[model samples]
Each structure stands twice: as structure tokens, then as C-alpha cells.
Target: MRALHVITGLGVGGAEQQLRLLLRHVPAQCDVVTLTNPGPVAAGLTADGVRVIHLGMRGNRDLGALPRLTRLIRTGGYDVVHTHLYRACLYGRIAARLAGVRAVVATEHSIGDTLLEGRPLTPGVRALYLAGERLGRATVAVSPAVAERLRRWGVPGRRIRTIPNGIDAPLFAHDEVARKEARMFYGLPEDAYVVGGVGRLAPGKRFDVLVRALAELPGDVRLLLVGDGPEQETLRRTARALGVADRVVLTGERPYLPDPGDDAPGVVALLSAMDVLASPSAEEAFGLAVVEALAAGLPVLYASCPAVEDLPPDAAPGALRVTGGAGAYARELLRLRAAGPGGREAPQAVRRYDIAYSARKLMDVYTAALAGSTLEVSSP
Candidate 1:
């Protein structure tokens, strides 16, 4: 079936990268629509031969883009219109309904009890989201925690479906040679014990907690902050103030590499190079990077990651949920280092998130939506 996927922007965030990976495995013909800033991720989609339409939306108040998107959806003759992120969900659902699309679905990638996009979940925003949600046949949550949050927000239980984000497991498998190469490329000593964190450098992510935790760790232990955002300068200053400036390496923002084959030198390589991964964010919807690190056979110490917490310990043997506080994280780092330099192999449970498996599950959702059923699928 022909499908149209709409998102806010094509930046290198988790939701955008997840769309890129999902398209690779989905058998149906799919096209993409980006509201604005069709950045690097758009180029990757084009290279893969997918059609990406950019709607030049000036800002949120730009109502003109609504009619434009509606016309495109109607003209494209898509069987299903799937939306992602905040702005896309708001506009795409209305546009799909206006365009007379029978199957409308949206994936709620980021939503928490306290915040939505780093801001408080005000009542006004909740009202608007609930209104928009009614236009869709189903809303897919990336984790059961997210599904529970949706229910708390007053969405009916039948309207929500839990579909955990999938990764290309084998692509991130640990590699000794690649690990050495990644360390060399980043100018890190081969023996340096690295603690890495990947995601948007935002206040909500609490990357500063990692900087503080780094200060408490031994001098030889280094911190690798991947991705970038408004918190870059703040994190840099925090590292400098804490006297660990030399040890903290901020790689800025890197392109999202969905399929990192054995030799691809992007995120997968960075994950391979790290001894252990640390995610100190107290608020996380899914923790895609944590899962990717697990796929790369790196042990993860997370403070508040719903993705890993929802699973049993045996499901992700390498993941450990630590309490909030830099000292707590520092202690965990020392304990992990004492064991070994490299992380343990990924558990067999990680295979549940394979992109192929997710594609099949998504097809079921699409089929059910087309058939006019709001039945929720069992979580993986």
C-alpha cells in the first residue's frame, strides 16, 4: 500500500532517524513530508530513492501550509498517512482528515508526565493535543511507559498502540578493530576509559549531570558528549569549571547513520569505541541511544530511562538503572571499570527490536487502521 509519512523536520534526532530505518524495512511504497528545515536526514532519504516533499512553513502560525499539505495528501492518493513528532501530528492529522484519507496514524515519540518538548505540559497544550488526536485512527507509543502517559493524558485505552522503536541490531554489533579505529579518529588514547552519552544536548536531557559525574570520576576516565543543542556552551563551561575540560570531548552534532555496516564511521563507531554508556537524564521517553549502545555490546547506566526500565533485567543484561545524582553515577562508573575495559555482549532479548520485526508489526497496525479497527497490539 502507498503511505505518506509526515514529520516536523528532518534533523538527526531519534524520531527522524527511526523513520529512516523503518522505511528501509517496510515493503510498501512510502513518501515523506517535512514541515520545515529539511536538513541532513532529508538528504539521506533522497539518496535512498524516497520522495521527500518540503513544506516551507515560516513558523507555527503559518496556516497556509495546512491547505498545501492537504492538497498534497489528496493528490498523492496515499492509503495511509502516518505522522511523527509534535508539529507534524498537529497539522498532518487535520490535513489527512481534510484530504479524506481513511487511515490516519501518529507515533508519539516524546511525551512525559511533567513535560512535552522540555516545557511543562500545560493544560492549553493538552487540550490542543487531545483535539488533534481525535482525527487519527490510532496513536503509536514507542514504549509502554509512553502508552501509560497517553492514558494519563485522558486518551482512551483503545486508541493507543505500543510499538517499541526498532534498531538494526547486527549493524551495531561490537567490533575490536572498529573500536580501535574510532578511538584513533577521535584522538582518544586506546587505553582511556570512556563514558559516553548520546542525544540532543538540552536541559531536559540533564547532560550537565554527566559533566558533574565526570568530575567525580578518576582523571583517566573521559566523557564523550555526542550530538548537540542549546546546552553545548553550558556543558562546555560546566566541564571547564569542574576542571575536567581536557577530559570532556564534545563532538558537536553528527549525522544520523541508520545502517552502520561493519566499517561505517559514525554513531556505531562511537558506540563501539566507548567502554560504557551513561544516560543521566531523569526524563526519557524511550532512550534509543541507550538501546543502540546495548546493541553495540556496551553496558549502560541510566538514571530515568523508561525504555530500559519497562523491560526485565534479563531482557537487557547490560543495562542498569541507577538513582539520580552525579555521585551515584560516578560510583557506578568506577564499579564498571573495575570489571573490564570493553562492554559485555548484547543479550538475545535485543533482537526483539530488529527493524525487520518492527516493520511487520507496523504493517499490522496499518492493516488494522485501514480495516477500521482501533484494537491495540500487544507490546514487544
Candidate 2:
């Protein structure tokens, strides 16, 4: 299959990194086109031997980009055009249709009750979304909750496909040697209990809550924050105000999945060094980091994870649902600390969300779109 993927930006966010990882496993001649902001992931894609093109879009309302994208798609001879994120989907769908490509697919990676791609959803946004959705053959929701959200937004049930995100479970398997090395590299005490949070540091992510919660914990307990965004300074100031500045370690953004043989410890070693993972985001299309932490045998506290809630409760035994806020997080951290549930066995969710399996499922969706049909499967 020859596929062309159009995404809003190629930054180091979850959706962007997921695209890079999925392409490594997809067995198709795939190319990427970033409408704007072709950052690190674009380079990574090119390094992986995939052709990448920058569309040079100036801004959201840049109508000039439409014609350029359409001309590219028209000349690319692609069997399928897949779009990701909100802005890309809106423009990519229209461009694909204008270019006479019938097999168009879009993945709705983040659609919450009142947010799309971490921004407020206005009536104008909804109108454009619906209009573009009509042009595509299918819209893939990362979780059943997201799929239901699409249905509530009036997208036809037949056009909605529920395909959850996936991860490489064994790649994150816990390692005691890595734990020591990561701790040594970060100057953390060997006996200290580490609490970790991983994601873009945005206001909606509620990482400030984690910072405040750190102040309430014992002096020996430490918090490790992963990823980077505009809220980094705000989080640091909050920690300083609460006198817990020394207890927080911000590693900035690391690769979502890194090569294992590299000298530096990737996300895998960081997970091994932590005692638990906490995600305080109140809204999410799918809780990807929660699944990766489960694969690492770490207990998790998540505010809203459709990824776990969509499955049977028994699927992720190490995961616990909690409300968002500093007080709530502080109380839960203390409670879990007292419980002292040591490293656990990888849960059933690990195997269920393997990245290899997800790539195969996506290829199935691509095949169906090309055939002008729907791929049916059992759903809850």
C-alpha cells in the first residue's frame, strides 16, 4: 500500500511520536507531510528512511496552503491519505477530496468533552470539524470513549472506527540495574520513593497539582517530571513557593520510545527508577503513558484514562482512578506509599495494547478504506 500521512505539526508530542513509531512497523510505502512546524519528529522520520515534506503553512487561516497541499496530493499517486490531529484533518480531508483521492482516513487522537488537541472547542471549531469529517471515508478514535464522543458530535456510526493506541510492552520491562543508573544520573537517593508524571506540561495537564502535591509528601519522596511545554516555569515557581523545589526533577522532553542499546537511559530506565506514575489530566482521548507504566510494572494513578476505563476493570490491576487536584493527589500518594505495593507483574493490558498489534489493525483500516468498505469488529 502507498500511503501519505498529513499531520498538523511534527513536534515531540504523543501523537507525533506515535506516528513515527507506528510507521516503523507498518508494512507499506508511507510518506509524511507536515502542514507546519516540522520539528524533531520530522527529522526522526527521515532518519528512518521515510520521505518527509514540509508544506510551509504560515498559520491556521493560510488559504494558500490548501492549493499547495492539494497539488502535492494530486501528484503523489497515493493509494490512501491519512490525517492526524485537528488542523491537519480539517485541511487534509478537503485537500484529499479535491485531489480526487477517495480513500481518506483520519485518526482522532485527542477529542475530549470540551477540548480538541488541548484547546477549547468552540462552535466554529465544531462546524469545521464536521465539515471536514464528511470528506473522509473513516475517522479513527483512539478509544471507545472518543468514538462515542464522535457519535455525540453527529459523526455517523458507520464512519467511526475504534482503534486504541498501542505500545511495545517488553521494551519497558523493569530493570534494577537501570533503576540504579537512572537514579545515579539524576542525583536521587537510592532509598527515596520516586513519583513520576509524563506528558506535555500544559495547564490542562494539571502538572502544577503534582508540584503542589510534592510539598505535602515526606521530605525523602521525590517527583520526576517528563516532557516539556510552556508550563515549565510555572511549575518550577509553584514548587519554589511550596518549598519543594529540591524535591522535583524536570528532565524535559525525552523520546517517547528510544533505542535500547544507546548509552543514555531512555524512557524505559526512567520508568524503572520510579515507584509510581501519576497522570492528573482531567481529560484524555487515551491514556498512553499509563499503559507504558503498566508495562514497566509500576502502579499508576490517573484522573481520566479512557484507555483503562474502556476495558474490564481487571485488565489493568496496577492502575487506580483518582480525581484531579493537589489535595487529592497528596492523599493518594500517601495512601499508596503506606500500602507499599512493590513492583508488579506486567498486566493483561500490556499484551492487549502491543504496538505491533496496533500497526496491523491500522493496516486493516487502510485496506478497508481503499476497498470503499467498512471493517467491522466486536466492540464493547
Which digits, one per residue and each the tens of the lDDT, describe model 2 over residues 245-348?
A: 99999988777455555455567789998999999999999989898899899999999999889777688888899975888999999999999867567987
Runs of candidate 1 with Cα error greater than 4 angstroms are 256-264
TM-score of 1: 0.96
lDDT of each: 0.88, 0.89
Model 2 clash pairs are none
**Candidate 1, pairs of clashing residues:** none
TM-score for predicted model 2 compared with the true structure: 0.96
lDDT of 2 at 249: 94
Angstrom error at residue 64, model 1:
1.4
- lDDT score at residue 331, model 1, on the 0-100 scale: 90
Give the Å shift of residue 71 in candidate 2.
1.7
